[model samples]
Target: MNKQPQGNIFHTPEMFRVFDQTKGHKSTLWAVVDNDNCPLALLLPVHVTLMNGLLRQLTTRAIAYGSILSVPGTAGQTALALLLQTYKREAKGTALFTELRNLSDLGQPQTLLNDNGFAYEGHLNYLINLNRPAEELLQSIGQRTRKKIRKGLRDGFVQMSEATTLAELEHWYEILQKTYSNAQVPLADRSLFMAAFNELYPKGMAKFLLAQVNGVTAACSIELPYKNVIYGWYGGSDRAYSDYLPNEMLIWHILEWGANNGYGIYDFGGAGKPDEEYGVRDFKAKFGGDLVNFGRNVYVHNPSLLKLSKRGYEVYRRFFIR
Candidate 1:
């Protein structure tokens, strides 16, 4: 019997570069290389912080996030499978679970994930095609949205500015904090956005935008460029200026910016479920983007630990965060 040849496996430096450029999540990258030393597949595992308790341990998740490059055809699947097996073997006593959020259009990844013991969790995302001319793109938006944009400009005295300094970041983050507080949702640490802006702005991978009313900041957004798509990562508006429609203007400005910059698509980030009546989804739908359902895929290494961690996190969210 002949033994199968083993390919080279190691972490690439580019992973660190990516880790710095996006949402400030602590991440490590792993890749499977071919015999010729070319990378066939890449995996990025992110560390998620859960509640800390002595017998109830929480797990870190490995997310694909923005980039999940792979070779064409089944070679990618083979590389991913091999990487998962290696990860499971090496990740003993480390993380309680692992997940891979596949790219929106990654052929058919569920088969490979299922074969590797991963369960599927469906999610909805909205994508705006930016290949068309700006005029056509504007015309495609809902009439009410267009009116709101115009109203924001004409009545609200809204002005859009590109943020370039830490002061601007602080302003954007303050607005974010208010927005999250108003909604009663738990916001991530401010350090995450700060780190992301500090790293990605210099690399030209991210943009922080602010919409002001009469020189007062009323709305803000963070746009990230990955591959050929621009993602509207985070956005918020002042409820005081709700009648002015600052958010509508902010979104329209983002779309125009994407078109002018030659980006092929504008991702509205994640929407809610298909049958759900979510205000966020309804707002995104007015922009004339397509709704996609390429959900998250999860693979658990230790079911018992994962269950305990989830229950603990739920309690934390309900009592402490809320």
Candidate 2:
């Protein structure tokens, strides 16, 4: 259980480490407001991944995964001031700012961060409320796309729960690896996915869904069901199944499964880059889901430092990511 201290908001390294694993960042720095005893507020740098040629980072309520919890009195601004007190103290340092992506207000750290010297970098987010009826939703889809989904249903693809055991996570892992291989992108640690899955499965917090053809796993998805909403967090499909419309069909099945199972909303997770809606935006719009402007945050030491940091990030990504 999470232990809360008296009045001080103490930050725990365990929480920050979890964020690091989920975000897949190379370097991270952490801070918390505490009276030297209990842990209250949580703060850490996410996406400290090499970007433009600088040490870039974003600090938020829970900078790990998508949604993280914070202490009752902790706020973004509160976390920022404490964070800045350390980084800013490093004399001759350039301004350091972070762009928090795909975050909506449920424990927002922005209001407080801005108070301490953070600034609104820009809007970065998307939300698919699982509160609408399937009929209302299907009616909104483009006629052509709707036909594809119907065709998928007519096909033999079926959804099955794949969270019966740790072995079940293996199937999901294979799908994730295939996705990365197809895109030539770096794959995150499978063990991390397992830890998350094992921890949340029983609580019904998340589940792994599979679509098979001839009993062979062709497509799979990892979804998180929390509160009244179900998030289509992660999933991948075989391109060969594209002809069968596996992606659309799998999603349709997920929606149907959620509705019948008592879930109200099905979040399609974030689309593309959090700030802009170009490609992924159009994709989600095809589902007839409404666009939601999500809140984001940026914390920096100052202007000069921020500029220098950007330059550093450019060089870093070029050497590391590219």
Candidate 3:
């Protein structure tokens, strides 16, 4: 745990400690403190092994925003520069590259990144303002979205919070697996989800919202509350109940819950690029939120190895893993 005033829950020691315990990802908290030993800036970099440690990469803490927090000024930039240099030196012989993925609207430190030889990776995200009145927020949503929520409610769908039982967790994981399989994408290991649910839910840092239809789980979403923002982390729906539109209902309920609980923002997580025609982005946009850009800042410490590792992973995915 790094000694600092508690601000963002994502930047907290308990969060990283849980990540270390459950996800098997090693995280190091780097900070620049003031004269009084108060942290002026902080960055959490996670170290991960690829291809069984044949290759390594230093990336921002998994499942959280990767922006160095500092007082509103050059302090952040200075700390970022120092952190980059430190990471470079530490990962010289170990990591192929280092990457930082910032939260939306947290603009990239272009000058510093450029000076440090970091490349820009653009992204888009949606943020639903929860400051407005609940009714006003509901009215702001697209008509189709509102209709879906209404239909789900009319159909007797109920929302459940924080699945505590193993059976519930297993059911949610099953839906997640199906969702990924249907999309033709590989599913992330279920352990990560379990770990978060087990560790953060009790502390009120995470919420697992489940939409049920006739006693059966129809849709579920995992949200993380950090500071005043509630992040829509991961979700999946039972395609069999798609007509009921449980997903729409789930999000609406989650938004209502967040608003009622005094959360100022509901982050729809990562959307695709602005120019891209992404269904996920379109779905998220219907809920009425601002689309913002704040993307990845990448630095290649060992370019040749990075390229080689990427190629090797692609080959492995195509021939073995996939």
Q: State the displacement of the C-alpha of residue 151, model 2, in Å, after optimal TM-score superposition.
A: 2.5
User: What is the C-alpha lDDT profile of model 1 across 78-140, one tens digit per residue?
Assistant: 897898778778865566767665446655555776777777777788889998888789888
Per-residue accuracy of model 3 over 1-322 as CA lDDT, tens digit each: 2232224556777667655654445666777777888666677766554334323342212222455565446776677678667756776654566666667444445667767776777888888999978888898899988877776677665655557777788888887777776766545567767777767887888887788777788888888887778888789988888877888888998899888989899988889876778999989989999878877777776766666666766665566543
Which has the greatest lDDT? 1
Whole-model alpha-carbon lDDT for candidate 2: 0.56
Q: How many backbone clashes does candidate 2 have?
A: 23
Evaluate all candidate structures by whole-model CA lDDT and list the values in order. 0.72, 0.56, 0.71
> What tens digits encode model 2's per-residue C-alpha lDDT throughout 171-253?
77888788766755555667557655655666666678887766766788887766556776677878776666656666777
- Assess the local accuracy of residue 173 in candidate 1 as a C-alpha lDDT between 0 and 100: 93
Distance (Å) between predicted and true CA of 78, model 1? 2.1
Candidate 2 lDDT at 39 equals 38
TM-score of each: 0.86, 0.67, 0.86
RMSD of 1: 5.6
**Candidate 1 — which residues are off by over 4 angstroms?**
1-25, 51-56
